[model samples]
Target: MTHQVTIRNTGHRFPAQDGSTILQSALDAGLVLPYGCRDGACGSCKGKLVDGRIDYGRYSEKALTAQERAQGYALFCQAKPLSDVAIEAREVRKAGDIQVRKLPARVQKLERAADDAMIVYLKLPANERLMYLPGQYIDILLKDGTRRSFSMANAPHDDEFVQLHVRHVPGGAFTDHVFQTMKERDILRLEGPFGTFFLRDESDKPIVLVASGTGFAPIKALIEAAFKKGVKRPMRLYWGARRPKDLYLNGLAERWVAEHSGFEYVPVISDALPEDNWSGRTGFVHRAVMDDLSDLSGHQVYACGVPIMVDSARRDFIQNCRLPENEFFADSFTTAADKAR
Candidate 1:
């Protein structure tokens, strides 16, 4: 059984399949409804149920309090329509729609994902939550007023711990500390939810996600968010690293490919040694995309990584592959070295 869902302000209507949450069904129908943490932990998906009944699914009390429920507010991420329903929700069309915040987070855990990469998990204060779009980054404030920026690796839905994939730079101050001394329970001040490098939900075009090294962090967030939102658009991810081990989360990406129908993952290694025994695609990551997708005029690309890869992909895709200039979105991971140059 399928029921129709109507947006009160937008007048857009889509069918909610039986047992599917309204948010999931809306996304499947290509609607860009406002949402964060599809797991019912964040109230960003909270909206007024204008009409019709719904089975309010599992959600944290803090997210949808009993008082809010009495007032007709439902966490759309967890609400399944029992009949034709009309809901009031503000669609997030731009980064400006969400607020930027400054908060303190405790380093709950730190584990090395690779020889040069550390996966850092941050826990925000219990009474606070950072509302951010997938693919946005946060800045860690240093005592000297310098800031180190890192993308949030975890999707908004998995916000119990804000995750960051930090690559250690040999002589860099912040990263050296992260590699040498950063420990669990260390408190750090951070500001943001910054950057416009998020998904343009309004577009229904197939997506090409490119990442290099730790740039995979935000890309990971975007992919997880898409899965939770029920986005069915075809997506192919190109993750490039110098060696197989540098593709630290290779297993996780492979799992996504095995589990999802319209998703594909290609791991490219540029400088694999004989010991690495690499059998997969070789060469530059962006070039691999170009070789396979000669025609990208109808596609959208989200790229993150070092400046060279991001710049090359943006230029080549638009010039050679006929991809539209506006369709290219990127965030270049610039280090102190790059800035010096």
Candidate 2:
């Protein structure tokens, strides 16, 4: 049985096949609702269930609380409609309006950005171009039917080749291949550009960009795209890593600070060793933000990287700094271990 699903404000309607989540069906029908870590770990797809019944599928308690569910909220990514359903959700317009596509790409080059991070450059067919918003990600389709998601590190304005910063996940099949076996000219199929973590251009609020480890990939894209569009809004980036070596693109960020008067870069190292002789901010990256900017009421924050860092920033900023809930955007990097839970 197929159930009809309607978006209350937009009046957009789609059919969800039996057992399919509302989000999956809507995306298949060309409606892109905000989402991250589609496995129900992120609350990006949470919305009001305006009408009709649904089977709320398995989801993390942190993503959808008991009180939220009792209040008629549902994680659309995990909710399957039992009947004709009406949902109230903000529809992303400009960034997600483009069609998702699947295409083949060849590895143009691979450079080691750090001991654990590899910068991969992929070239599409001569006539093919991927039109995507900054801060979106692509899922590399593996031969074994599983997919690994990596964000495009390059901005859309420089899209001659897609760039990805892949961290070697120990014992992971894909990362193992990328680090040890994958070679230049290797062909891979990919589907993208996904996620709703892009900049909200309508807001002129000063921006605070946060990234950790390889989570910096999408943040890099967002920053580059913002600069290319000549957005003069004050932008500050707080990049957190375990050690100084992990801030692989520190030079690039420093150059941005030198060239752009509106831009500021802060690198935070959490576990700097005595040998490292780090002389910058130390401690959790998000904490560094709180220390410097006591108030974030008028700022828009874009955060990506580890789930803990993203979650911490979202909670602390909204609870203490008076940042509006909607003003905080993030993409949490969830591993297979996280999904298993």
Candidate 3:
């Protein structure tokens, strides 16, 4: 059976097959919905169930609490319609314009960015190009039928090769191989250009970019894209790590500050040792943002990081900082361990 889903805000309607997720159905019908970590680990797809019933499929409690479910909110990425439904969600435009494809790529280079991070560069077929928004991610298909996701660190204009900053997750099948054995010229399969973490170029508000660890992958792409397009809006970046050595691209970020008059960079360390002689900001990365900007109501925040950081930022910014909830965009980096939990 098929149920009709009505977008109450836009009056758009789509047909969803039984057991099919609302997000998949919307995409199937050529409509785009804001989403991240489609596995239901991120709440980016959460919206009001204006009417009707849904399975409210398996999801992380952090993504959708019981209270939120009771209030008629659903994670469209995991929600399956039990009947015709009406939902109030923001319609994303332009995302559906680029097609998602599976392509073969050759590992062109592997540079050790840090003790636990590897920077990978993959070259596509001679005539092929992946047209994607700055902050989208691609899934690396593994031989065991599982997939590992990583954001493209290179901007669209700098697409000669796809770049990914992969942090070594010890004991992880994919990351272990990437660190222990994967080498230059090896072939890998990839599919995607997924997520809704890109900048909302239409908004004129100043931008606040928050990132932690490898989450900087997509943020790096976003900043380069903005610069390529000559976006003049004031931008501030807050990047956090456990120690000074973990800030792998510190020099690059510093160079961006030196070159761009409208851009500023802040590096925060949470667990610095005395021998490291750290003098920069110390504490949670998001907390650093909250401390510096008492008022985020007039700014648009784009955050990418571990679920905890992303979730905390989303909650505190809206509640205490008076930020408009709709202005916050995020892509939560859910690891395999996170998914298992």
Candidate 4:
């Protein structure tokens, strides 16, 4: 039996099928909803359940506390409607603006930027272009039924095919395929323009871009977009990596620094092997930020990379660097291989 539910604040009706999450139905119908992660791991999709019953799928308690759930809060990604529901939620704008779409993509080029980093270029058909914000990411749905998310390294301009930076993980499923098995002329299915971690153009606050490994992908896109849009905002980038090899885009960043007057790039190295012949500031990447900027209360930070880096940076920036917690935006790249550890 198809369930009919009235969307809160909408005069229209929706057909809710059994076991399907509310967010999925909204996306399928082009009625976008504010969401992130879509795995019940991020609370970006959390909203009030004004009136309804739904099962809470496998979600982390960190995303939604039991207290919040009891207080009518539900994660849209995990909530499946069992009755007519009224959700007091944010309108599908900004991050939810781009409708989710699946498109045929072909690997146009593969450029190995570093010993362990590869920037893959997927070409779209002439007339098939992905409309994505600067910091959004797309999931390459693999044939094995696994999804790998990568942020667009290039800004969307005149309908260009999407771009992504893939870093090799020691036994990673997707990265291994990308480095060893993937090739040009390869066809893949992609669904996205997802993630809420994008630049807030409205803020003129001094920007601090923090990146680790290939996490710089989205930060690069965001900075490029900001420059292309002629944003004169003073921006400084603090890229942290283990040894110089991790920052494969060092030259590219130097070029950006030379071209942009308001941009500054600082490379922070965590560990330098003795034989590697390294000379750089050595410490936690976030600690480097703390060392440089004593006060980050007025700055907006966009950080990406390992969860440890984001978490550490967030904690330090708030507690030590004086950065407001809300101003610190992060995209944690949690890999399956890291799950075991």
Model 2 agreement with the true structure over 1-341: per-residue lDDT tens digits: 99999999899999999999998898888788889878788788899999999999988887888999999999989999999999999787633357789999999999999989999999999989998899999999999898888999999989899999999889989999999999999999999888889999999999999999998999999999999999989999999999999999999999999988999999999999999999999999999999988899999999999889999999999999999988999998887876664
Model 3, 50-137: lDDT tens per residue? 9999999888887888999999999999999999999999998844578999999999999999998899999999999998999999
* lDDT, candidate 4, 22-131, per-residue tens: 78776666665666567766565778888767777777676678999989899888888887777766554433456678888999999998888898889887877788
- Counting clashing residue pairs in each candidate, in order, gives 1, 0, 0, 0
Which prediction has more favorable lDDT, 1 or 3? Answer: 3
Residue 16 of model 3, lDDT score: 100
User: Distance (Å) between predicted and true CA of 220, model 4?
Assistant: 0.7
Candidates 2 and 3 compared by lDDT, better number: 3
Error of 4 at 179 (Å): 1.5
**What is candidate 1's lDDT per residue for 1-341, written digit by digit as tens?**
99999999888889999999998887677665655445565455779999999999987775678999999999998999999999998764523445667899999999999999999999999978888889988999899998888999999988899999999889999999999988899999999776557888889999999999999999999999999999999999999999999999999999999999999999999999999889999999999999999999999999988878987998799999999977888877766665431
lDDT of each: 0.88, 0.92, 0.93, 0.81
Distance (Å) between predicted and true CA of 164, model 1? Answer: 0.4
How are the candidates ranked when ordered by TM-score, highest leading?
3, 2, 4, 1
Better of 3 and 4 by lDDT: 3
**Model 1 global lDDT (CA atoms, 0 to 1):** 0.88
Clashes by residue pair, model 4: none
TM-scores for all predictions = 0.72, 0.95, 0.97, 0.83
| C-alpha RMSD in Å of predicted model 2 compared with the true structure | 1.7
lDDT score at residue 2, model 4, on the 0-100 scale: 53
